[model samples]
Target: MRAIDLETQVLAAVERIRKGEKTENDLIECKRAWPSNNKARQLAGSLNRAAGDAVIYVIGIDEKDGSIHDTSDTDILDWWSQIVGQFDQVPAEMVRHIDVPISNESVVGIAFSSDRAPYVVKTGSPKPSLEIPIREGTGTRTARRDEVLRMLAPAIRVPAATVLESNFSAVHYPPLASAENAANDYRREESVHAFGTADFFVEHDGRDLVTLPTHAMDGIIEVGDLSFTLNVTPDWFQSETKAPRKEYIDRQREAVLISGPGVVPLRVDVEGLLLSHRKLLETTNSVTVRLHLGILHTSKPLVIEMELNTNPREHQLPEDLNRWSVRGK
Candidate 1:
């Protein structure tokens, strides 16, 4: 599920609980405060095995009375580390940290899913042992032999990812496409630089955990009549790199590896203009841009579409073009 979707679900659950109404989903659990590291590990581990779909552990409200509890001071990253530190080989990207704003404060939620079941957590005294804890209807228990075998058996695998977050800014220079400036303007001119930032994460399979490598991703941008390709170059992509183990990160972060930021450079040219350069002055004030991305492992392609102003206000331009002139020497 997308982060926003998780936030919505948690907010709704919180409201329902506050009104003394029982939520229909047993996969959701509420906590008054951040559980101890040990407890946090247990809850995460159990939920990893228990959930057949998206499950979440929300913190900040009293589970019993549904009263709002304060947990704003906790660092979300630290809390995430606490959960990741518990297991040696927990399902990859098994948990995502979610922040929900409520009553002028932010609450923490942990989203978990695992198909690579038997996500065993390390527990016990001097002789630590791996235990596969499964949550069964609000209760957790050790997985039975048959259950363990079922989890271990080969299951259908579908590599996937979701756009966790994305933001972009673009401008279309209508004047540059005018027939009057055909001689002054080059065939192509850089219109928008630093197009945007995007975070993509491998979509979790409830029955099995999945990882989509960042190295296998490529993208393209289409604006008006122009199309350009984009690339995701993680540090590990370099041959001389010594970065830690690299995972195929699809814009996913934290428990999921977040690929390096990709800056989309857009060049608008007279020839690429959708309308004839002869009629460019009559073009509308805005143009639609689309970004299409594909991952080597996933069949689904990520597409983002946005509109940019062809002739922005004076303040939006880097320089006052009205005061400038393209005069022949």
Candidate 2:
């Protein structure tokens, strides 16, 4: 019942079908190449036959890479409305339509429930019939008439009052003691900063330029005895600058690698390092060396900021400082 993106959801649906978790015939693919009205009607008919047990999902309007490109000339909201109307003609059915955003594309999910009688689809010149079964797979036959009837059969609805409830237990919770122990024992914080070096060479250029780290400008050498190394690309750098000669502004396109004792190696994007570097840079005009660490997420990357000041004139700080420690507002 959950609405999902067509590209991602379709793959899941396919997985379910392949595993026999869900019937493959229940899925349908509608592409922009086909007639929209005809496809809509076919989908409507399929829904009617299954009485609301069937789910019709759409895909392929977006590009093959699953990027969203607006195709329909009409308003999407209006088009969705018309799609619902067409399916509503099916008798004794409740249809639920949902629009899911996947990447740059929009995927529509239609779930139909038939609570009353057998669903029927109206084909050209022929009256509504129950023979048209929902297809579960490519080259697979539709559900048989008897099988469809069985699915449509009205079973006694179980009352919630009759269902037994069990007491909840905290045993399923993640061990708090283990987490607390880890937090208490291994407590060290670190920060990172990303700076562009002119000496770096470009490997390739397309959407983003691939460059290499230069020994002269890279900031890791400044962190004395903290024990840090690049976790991502040791030699290569991804440049975000569209034009090479543009003024060196601290943009979010740069990424850096970082690793140290008790800290997991990570690749952090430029933005994360800047946020961490803000305080140090603002406080002192004297150039302080720092390592830019990138933290990769499911969708994006984050930067960790660590500072190293080796100036003999300035106050010497503790060697084992916790970089993860946050100052409270």
Candidate 3:
């Protein structure tokens, strides 16, 4: 995410939020209301929810009582810093990026990305605080104990079956198959029997067969038949396997190659899988598995070539195998 100008920055930030791609939190409209302790606390709370990746922007003119008020305060920077420092007293260190202009009275932007672990914003006496992470719909909420624990837990790699069930809905590709049941045989299946879950299943109507997961649906690209299953551990969960061996395959570079101009090569070295069991954040049950794939050049339609294991985890639930219990479901 690169911002060439203020307008571009704002637009890009909003786009990321809408696409669920934002790594940090973001706020619009700054300095409308006069500064107060409560306002400061609210700002701190928003920053905290970002989990070290958050940005806030003060937009447009401040019109109060139907009058345009020009902000000419030169000491505004110092005042803002003082408010941010209030969080440190609660034993939470907040580092933010500040950008203000002498001529632009309409906009102010504040960006925060904490390098430290989770920070809490104190609200009342005895220090009742709220943990921070980008909220799904309303933008940040006080995380419950279980949610906090899930985030703090060590990374583990487990099978998908341990958490998810084998059930799915289907769709067809290409406009020719857009009819009610045209090409409906091109079906896919989604299984909750794993660590991280995926949506968008394709069901086969004729043979009653379902295609394996594919990158077209999510990050997964199926390589084999549905009957073939692997025995692997779920990522980012308490598991018996401490370290798992890396699996490699001969992937066709053309199928997953990315190319473009002005693109830099980037590499990610995933140590352990970063899996998330998120409920209420989205419309469906989701599990995310993080893995480190080495560096590659940045290109449009980024291509990834790898074989991933799709296996059920070692755990079982009392519900139907097709449906697994999820939060906010």
Candidate 4:
């Protein structure tokens, strides 16, 4: 699934639950409070039943009536980490929690998929056994061997990855577009860069100041004829960097709408502009001015500055405009 404004998404999803618009399914489960004791084991079991689908466990809401519980004392992230580690070692990116205004507690969202055959529960002291957990109606039970082999069939059919040891094409660019290999149109060609401004929003009730455009965002501005595009897709190419061991990461996704910000195109930079009084390179070096708003996302205000960098390079400039557009090596 595409990354969304976590804070807004969590709230909207929870709101749907409250209004009876959405309910649990094969890929979703809801919890009432922080998972502890037996609840933690049950949490692991639910994840196992997900079977590599986009599964979510909306925590802090009553499964029966969708009542919101106070979360002041429950630290969602800390609790999430403890549960994931004790039950099954899932990647940090796979499961995450978001805080909502509905309650002091936060809601958790997990998008998990695995090529590995069986994801099991660890129930032992030293020698832990891998017992594949399978979904049986409302709950989960250990999977039978025949069931597990079915799960592992895909991984066995293809090598997980192909290692390229020598010469390489540009990592950012896609491969050849020929009869054998098809190229994705949206990704392969360079996209036109959209320009905009960004502002910092701070809470009036004594809170931290933060950059605005990244989250709960809204903007409007008067400009020439222009249309906005959602520049959300990332390059499909993966870095070839082979690393040793690993390192530490402190980056985190925001829990609440400290603010929710997203991009909107106010105008388009095209041939009509008076750039050098000519429309020859109208598509190149064309500036599309957009407003980087704040108060809409949070309880704050913003001011514009020209000397400061107002260029929001959320997308790449056209291939012809880019300096490195020179052909050949």
Q: What is the lDDT of residue 156 in candidate 2?
A: 22
CA lDDT scores, all candidates in order: 0.52, 0.35, 0.33, 0.40
State the displacement of the C-alpha of residue 277, model 2, in Å, after optimal TM-score superposition: 55
Model 3 over residues 237-327: C-alpha lDDT tens digits?
Answer: 2235668833121123212121211111221211211112112111333323322222121111212223233223422433222122222
Model 3 local distance difference test score:
0.33
Model 1 stretches astray by more than 4 angstroms: 24-26, 91-95, 126-128, 154-329
State how far residue 258 of model 1 sits from its true place (Å): 34
Which candidate number maximizes TM-score? Answer: 1
Candidate 3 lDDT at 100 equals: 40
Better of 2 and 3 by TM-score: 3
Ranking by lDDT: 1, 4, 2, 3
Q: Over all chains combined, what TM-score does candidate 3 have?
A: 0.36
65-128 in candidate 1: lDDT tens per residue?
A: 7777788778766876776676657643545777788877767777777555667776755565
The predictions' CA RMSDs to the true structure, in order, are 14.7, 23.3, 18.0, 18.6
Candidate 4 lDDT for residue 112: 43
lDDT of 4: 0.40
Report the backbone clash tally of model 2: 26
- What digit string (tens of lDDT, one per residue) describes model 2 on residues 170-234? 00112235656658854333343432211111111123222223221222422222322332333
